[model samples]
Target chain A: MKPITKLTENEKKSALRIFWGQLRKVNRNVPEQDKIKFLKRIPFFELLKKHQLDEVARVVYEREYRDGEYIFEIDQPGAALFIIQSGEISVEIPTPKGEATQLAVISKNAFFGELALLDESPRSASARAIVPTKVLALFRKDLDKLNSTNPDITANIYKSLATIIGNRLKATNELIERKIKAVA
Target chain B: MSGSERSRKTRRIVVYSMTSIFFSILIAGIVYGLQPMILPFIIGAFLAYLFKPLANSFRGPAITKYIRAGALLFFVGSITYWGTTFIKASLPNEREKLQLKVRLQYRLNERYLSLMNLADGGKGNFIYKTLGQEFDELKKRVIDYVKMSDDERKRFLILQKEISDSDHENKKYYEYYLANLKNQKVDIEKLKSLAGSAIVAIEKPAGDDIGNLANIMRALSHWIILPLAFIFILLDKGQIFHFFLRLIPNRYFELAYTVAEKVDDALGKYIRGTMLECLLVGLTLFIGLFISGVELKMAIIIGMVGGLTNAIPFVGTFIACIMGVFYSLIAENVHSFLPFINENNLMIAVLAVVVIAHLLDNAIYQPLVVGSAVNIHPLVVILSVFGGSLMFGFAGMIFAIPTIVIIKVVTETLFAGLKDYRII
Candidate 1:
């Protein structure tokens, strides 16, 4: 019994230190590897280097949303990106033809509606959980802290994104053309 | 280079240039032709964005697209109805008030000549009498001038016609034709001068004034188009997403996806959070004020305004507070118009309610609504709101904070590498 109590005390101290370390890590100016791990899982951080990824991770936050919850709506102002960690979600977009269309199904490791974050555009779609969802999110407000000090990394990241978004646009057009042709 | 590589490179270049040009032109055209309408378009876009989540939330395989669409339309229509009715009801009263004010000023000038005398550097009580005498003289002269002009025009036309008719038949016809031709020439010259004047009128800068319901209607029309535009956008999101991805270099998919995801998350949280905050705050304020003994109608109106204004951040609180105070003064108990309420008591009561409402907003409403609305710091919120007001005037004041937040996120991610360095 005496030996068991001693073992428990040591374990408790280790747990306390670990918790304190995590808290300290969150407040640090430099980005953390754990944060980058989440960022790297997102498509936007794919091209970021170790340090750049860390900066993103620093601004990123993790949140859990219940089942049937809204990630966002069509007309709300948008200011962040959402990367699903667990559960499934769906995207609904309104058509000019006065229809709300199901755009896509997003699952774990999936992200939707990044365009709104990049510009002042309204949300193009609404996302809601099909199941309980966990998400890692990054808001736009903290981006300046990094930009003021590191211009090159910021430029590169944007340049990379521009290229990727550019490609997506091209592919979308092709698909649209194909659909039109098929319909015709 | 290999033949396959060369063709692929050419294809890539064409796609890149074409999409780039198309997007630029689309954005430019929107800005140029729809500048005034942009707000409404934005509103429409926001409506669509907000409802999209609800639609999705209700969606299962069984829910039809049309049903979802109907629900979205109904909800939006009701909101629009309420907003429009509020404006419609208020507008007539406001317009009448404005007209009365103008009329009162004119009457005052006529009766109280002393006011003008005071304005002018006139000596003693003599100035009042002098001004009264002058005004009377001016009024008489104006009435005479108008009467004289009408009489002259009437006499000239009659005399000209009589002269033409009294002559021999052939001579009369010839004389009449000549007179008609002379009148035509005068008319044409006048029209030409009028056209020249119109061109100058068009060149003058548009005057700044409080944008009224007409402006709102125009804005609404722009948003009406957005639903139509959004339909196409929604239907093609998959294809559009794919196309955007394909346009970028093959290596950049991950980066694009990350940026896209981040943006989506930010906007989604912001929109939903702000709206939720508005509704909750509006209802809470109404209930709170009513319970505290304020008039039910005024309380509801003030609450709604306060809640909506809270969405704007910073100065929104002050505007809402002032509105609340104004309503307290205007709204009298229906029971007694004869024994008018004391202004001092009303002021004190209003001040107390407004203080409580604001306190609740700052402590509970903000944390409950705004804290969860966006993740930016309070300092950032203040900075963004102030900056937005400076750049966009009132609208800018509302939007600037959110825009700053987005910028901050983007900057943080892009320059995540440089976070440790101190630029200042």
Candidate 2:
């Protein structure tokens, strides 16, 4: 009985060590502080209660795709807004000339699927993973439903969205202007 | 008529008969003037159709059937509570704002009249006064042109009569009338076109305005009726369904039941899914703003309105944005808790904040909410909504996309029986 008890203690120690090691491995790619900073940039989640934010963070998935993998196709309806978590994704738009041009390369922290959220518009452009890429997506339908039930959180999100749109328009115009000038 | 001609005539007669039946039913209802009370009930029934799933969810062993029923009741009660409270609370501020806006117009008008007087050879007017006067005169002149052009028909008719009658009197009068009439006619035509465009523009915004408010009320009403009706229906759903089933001719019993089931599913998915989507959006928005430390009541108000407004496809964005701005303005005015900044600076700050929030919503927020469920192509959705609004006024505009979605779903479902192809 004494020998069995000792063996059990040893086994427990080994199991604890293994668990710790696995946790370390999982967390090695992203530190807690960095995760907070990353989440800060996502405007929608900024106002989530500490507990709710934690719930989001826990479920937040990080997915990687190989270069040239289709992230989403134009006109393919999908749920979830993808935030470029790492690497780059190229946005391709078909010109009136009937050729696809790289309209933009969305980098880390950039997002897509907004037009879908406001209304169900088929995607205007196709997104291709330009490199090994990762994305964090939030489902609009789920989020909006939550908002109706919880007015306080909804209000915060509205403020965040208003500001984000204005800033993006400004930045996009600036980028386009620069591109035009360079070509000229 | 020939057999072919008779068939064509029969088809035309059938089509006209159906249309007239539909029109007459509505006209008859209106003739008796039962619309006001009936309208709300009809809307409520449609809503009950939409949120059938949510009502269904509040049933069965997964949740204690009693608890589920209570939950549904609670849902209805809460919606009523929040809706009335929000509207009641907001109405005063809204009225005050309107009053203030009117007063501001009146003040501007008074200043403008004085300035006009100064412009017309009124001496002893200072340089500042003259500048003010000039600005006022400019506005008056523009307004006069606008008002005059709006009534161009009467003006032109009178001018035409005068031109014909007076052409023989003074030669100068004839010459002047001819020139004035020619110029005025051209101006009048241009103004008419402008007015036509303006009418179109005004009609659009006005429809949206009514639709937006109606959407809020409608959404809130659904939250009430869906749960309430569902609970009662579930409690006696068997009886209700059986009674209808028994009423049906035995030959078409199964077909009728199946059609009812399909309608239930369509209404259920569309309404519940939409409601869920709106709620989620509102919550996410609220959480984001609170964490960001923005303290505007407008955010909450807008979020609520946005969730409600979001039911209208293509046009929802504009409605949501306008509501956001309006709420923000009210929030800024009513909340004195925040320290006062310069008024212009405060406006700029609010504007900046609003712009950023809208971007996040459009870019990141909206897609996450309704993207997966709404399969209609954006271009198609836009066109359908525009067409619907053109045809049926506000209600049509609001229901356009959803109706299209359901139609597409039904068409696909019906076709799927033929070949199992995905319609969406």
The prediction achieving the highest DockQ against the true structure is: 1
Model 1 interface CAPRI class? incorrect
List lDDT for all candidates, in order.
Answer: 0.59, 0.56
**Candidate 1 structure quality by residue, lDDT tens digits, A1-184:** 5554444888888987777568646755442565567667666667777656755665555556666667776755556677887899889877899866887898988777667547646677778787988877655544543465556566765676687789999999999999999999
Give iRMSD, candidate 1: 16.0
Candidates, DockQ:
0.02, 0.01
Candidate 2 recovers what fraction of true contacts?
0.00
Segments in model 2 whose C-alpha atoms lie over 4 Å from true places: A1-184, B1-67, B93-98, B102-230, B234-270, B283-297, B323-342, B352-357, B363-366, B378-399, B419-424
Model 2, range A1-184, lDDT digits (tens) per residue? 5554445888888987787558545744454445556777776667765434543454333456666777666655444467788999999987789877998888988887665545545677888898988776554554565464445665675677777778989999999999999999
